[model samples]
Target: MTSSRSDTRSKIVDAAERLLREQGPTAVTTRAVAEGAGVQAPTIYRLFGDKDGLLDAVAEHVMATYVSAKAEIVRAASADDVDPVEDLRAGWRAQIEFGTANPTLFVLLSDPERARRSPAARTGMDVLRSRVHRVALAGRLRVGEERAVELIHAAGTGAVLTLLSTPPSDRDPGLADDLFDAVLRRILTDTAPFAEDGPLASAVALRAVTPALDMLSDAERQLLTEWLDRAISAASPVTR
Candidate 1:
């Protein structure tokens, strides 16, 4: 596409994302996105084909950003040698930190409707999941092929989402660390030395947020902690 066309498309996708985050997919009309983007309604159709097309573009854009970053973190965490469980903990923390830092983008990336509508978006998450599966199979973690990988992903993502949506005063910042340690301790080797370490451990502790944790606000941090509490409290079949 031409430079001006690409720029307009980017604006439209951004506007659509903003609308979806604010009002949800049903409210993100093409005309509305166009108006919000300062483009003509017909131009939206010309560029994206229709409303579904626009939504697909927007979802793909956000999902690309989220999945790519997540995959990188998982890949990086997999390289650590302290303990497989600690590496796994590092991976989980990275994932939570990412989602909590970008709550809107995380939701947009995980939207079921968007997955059904966009192959690129669906495949992006699939790639990330596949990496986690590989790690589990490699014995870096305790997840088996049956459903553990999915469960772990669900738990982690749900935890982060709940935390991001909750109020600061209602949360405890230390819960996520505690919950992560508990989960990893359950799945990782019980006899491992790194498993006993707490927040000070370099292997499991998020010393650096990869890029930076500075993007997150105080409220977002509080919400993330609340979500972690819920995730940690949830009863699982494994526990049963």
Candidate 2:
């Protein structure tokens, strides 16, 4: 049977996502996405407005995938009861794997246009900053003040972007986790003393970020949460 218009629109998005993975965001034009989805270029425009809109859609798709994979990775690994340092290492490794597997989408996250146009990108930064603050609260990491969380995110994102931009040959992919682990370790070590002491301290620290999460409207949070779930469902895992 012929697909419905909604189905067709979804196919266009799927096509955009694929082309982005195969040829980077630059290849994902209305013409290209339409052709890939076997629809006319006008259909793509009708569905998404313009090239930037398409890119925004694709970015939405990619961010969703990252969040889902993150949830899975954390859920699976949470059973390990590892030390704070080891927990950080595992998280770093999962992030590197996710990035390497979706290099094109990862590259798109680094795009200035994405930062400019996508609410998901902004929400992601909020979530990450919250996580950092949580670590500080839990005593797993040391962050001296509220502002320190933003400073840590700046440095961490810098490390992540640098690692993403560098090819494996230049700096062995195996070392990405170790390199980030070291960066996080140094940051956390300095803040560990300020952390609250308790058996559930780390968990409590993570909750500290709830205030940040609460900043978004309920509708916005739900929309983002659903989008993230769909993105993960759409992403096919690949070996690097």
- Global lDDT of each candidate: 0.61, 0.60
For 70-124, candidate 2 gives per-residue lDDT tens digits of: 5554445445544545544555555566666777666677677777666666665
Q: Against the hidden reference, what TM-scores do the models get?
A: 0.58, 0.63
Residues forming the 10-long window of minimal summed lDDT in candidate 2:
231-240
lDDT digits (tens) for residues 40-159 of candidate 1 = 999998998988777668767866776677666656655743344445566677677777766665676567776567666566556545554544434444323323455566677678
lDDT of 1: 0.61
How far residue 152's Cα lies from its native spot in candidate 2, in Å, is: 5.2
**Runs of candidate 2 exceeding 4 Å displacement:** 1-5, 75-84, 116-119, 126-134, 144-152, 164-167, 190-240
Off by over 4 Å in 1: 1-7, 18-32, 35-38, 49-53, 74-84, 116-143, 191-240
For model 2, state the Cα shift of residue 26 in Å: 4.3
How good is model 2 by TM-score?
0.63
